[model samples]
Target: MRRSSSFVLGAVALACAGPDRDAAPASPTSSDATGTSGGSTTVSGSAGTGSATTEAGDTNGATIGDTTGDDGASSSGGAELGVPMFVAQGMVGRTTVSCDDGLTWIGERSWDVEGDAHLCGSTTPVDCSGSGSTCTQRWFDGSCSEEACDCGHSPGFSKGVEHGAGRFVATWGWGWPGAVATSTNGFDWQTTLDGDTFGGLRYGGGRFVVASRTPQTSLDGITWTASQEADFHGDDGVTIWSVRRFGFADVDGGRFVAYASGDTSVDTLISSDGGGSWWRPRSMPSDCLGEGPGAYGDIIAGNGVIVMVDGDGHACRSDDGGSSWTAHTITDSRIASSGVWTGDEFWFWGFGSRYSSADGITWTTTPIDAPDDIGPVARSPEGTLVAVNNVWLGYEQQAFLRSTDGVTWASLPDGDFTPGHPIFFIAFGHAEPSAMCPGT
Candidate 1:
């Protein structure tokens, strides 16, 4: 079942240097991968109230806008239920926080290798399964010393993080081995798959799908099945081999959409039967990749609509389920890194002012105070919007922001997270797996 909020909803640049780039060699096998709107609803107080409701058409529907509450803690008064915590993945590591109401956040776990160093000799990869370690590691030549470290790898860094179909999934990008981390509860994680992987992850139709040079799917996010066709040939006679990079993958209108951009062209692939089969829609326009400095951006699906935008001011939207697309230019030359759907509107944000649209075309600009890139936004089931700025730099005190109405934002305190660590993506997901299945 699709996760929903009573209201309605809704990336990263692939070329920028991830914080881990200095510590680790880029994965030769992986591919580079890599918002807001309306309202002025104010959420007051701290977080973790567990009093927010996400069911649509509630009596409070008429009260969603222009309402003020006592200053106890902020509450969206909506968000997807069963989601007990917030999951964040970035260059520093993966961490979780508990905030039932999406206002006052409390730390849950820092799920990355922080202080501990693992040694695996010159050619061997560091084994991060030891105590105080969880895969994100700096590899050294022959010792566990942090100095003279040659390379490092994290399953999910500045790319490939998605939450859906009952699990939160994160994966490593190019130059590293294919690694995936799955969590039913944000507090704990399991490395479910490794090897022969490229990260363009999406969970839908009762399964998890990864689109790469090869396409693979999993019923439980553990064992993956790869497709037989290694080369993806579009109806236009254009063929892309082993998708080099994924712009973004999302499920909207009960259809799974994955955007793949190679050296020559940009392609949009859609799967109607829960990722069991995929076919290219009419190919996205070439300019959808962007003419700006950063060539890539993100995609979002909701309310029978799918929209994609790149950092260079190009956008594409599909209303009839990816069969055809209409192109539009983002206003003010806005460079978008990420976007989201807020029940009633679509939003795109990046370097400067944020933009929101009721449809995917015309937009309304909202001013913000970020001096650097502001992006990778996510919404809670109860309708809280969380965004991080200075994605590559910035301290936690100034990096995290939350809003119930998307218009007003407040700084969020650091919760068991490294103060200066940069965040890549934020998602709301269940703390427990909804079910289990046998795997290969």
Candidate 2:
């Protein structure tokens, strides 16, 4: 959500106040992924009496400050509910304060630092002080070691994929036209495409496919050509269905299955010829509409099964390629925002919880120490699950988390990149020969 000008005014008032400040500090609230506007979050100091109502914004609602009583020791009226910590777009928000058994916000001291929006009281600085042609560090005990990395280049709301043999392709939504970057290792990167904005990027059937109004395909992830035969338009040809989200999976033999969700229409297109051509195989089940929006969900194929899950945890699976689908429940109550298949099991994180399933039919929830509103998770080149979480101070900042088994997670030192815009997607990429450089 756009920051209201009133936030500036509130900041000025708190800055000029006397040493014994009595007024509560104002914190900026965030909107949901759909860009839906909601109510304003109001927090008061002195008694720390504040109330946050559910809004149409991000699934996690708002991020507020710690409410403290007059004595600053005991709790009063501020512990009723919990607020979400901000992440990037489409992901759930986390809570900043430590909670009790009931999950109520109960931190005595305020985690919000005045004037610095990116600085968090709980954030630990990372040490990048090692030497190597390219040294890789690990996230241990909530801090990063002194190794360097080359994966810091900003792609402007980008998504990437590790094609194979250390080759990577990352495409962005806004910035230069056809904005794309390629890397050979997981670290270094170089721009390859500069044409039009792309919606999604995936690799299958011996090529890289980019989803847009008219999808494009490339064998090298550099030069691109439009799939003239691939059709996304409805039967009318005038009602062009917008491709919001899509997923690719390799079925039996070398054949691949691509499931695409439409932005405005309920019709979903399926491709069997490696995204060369698309046809409406079937419509989403009526019961799936309860999962929030029909156009928004994560479609993943792995372990010989293709799974499509909506925002509300409603899931459907296809075993005989994309020809047929069977709807199933996740058993958990929390709504899932994003999910990824880790070659073996399907893992989903949202609303302050993480769940994993090997068959996509039954799920097992795991306990996570991180915030509930964490961003999307992808398998890094090193075979670890990496995810990002945002800390909304005075400014927006990010936190990195890594899990080797997808069950237990650890925090990596914060990356140097502070997003100036909302990041819509992030995937693993390989480093290129020309893009290889010393780690910072």
Local accuracy of candidate 2 as per-residue lDDT tens digits, 92-165? 11111111111111211111112111111223222111112232222322232332321121112244333432
Tell me the lDDT of model 2 at 194. Answer: 57
Model 1, range 1-440, lDDT digits (tens) per residue?
A: 21111111101232342321221112111111113335321111111112111212111111111111111111334443454556666543345454454554444333233331222222322232122422333322222333221122342333456665456777654433436778766655676765434646655444666776567777777777876343454334566443423432232324556654334333456665545556665434433433321223466655556777555445566676666656565553445346766767776664446666676665566665543345567776557777665444334233566777665666555553344344556666655632221111
Relative to the true structure, candidate 2 reaches a TM of 0.56
TM-score of 1: 0.65
Which residue ranges in model 2 land beyond 4 Å of their true spot?
1-162, 174-178, 185-191, 233-238, 254-264, 282-284, 289-297, 331-337, 381-383, 390-395, 414-421, 429-440
Alpha carbon lDDT at 438, candidate 1? 13
TM-score of each: 0.65, 0.56
Off by over 4 Å in 1: 1-83, 100-158, 228-253, 289-296, 369-373, 394-398, 413-417, 433-440
**How many clashes in each candidate?**
31, 23
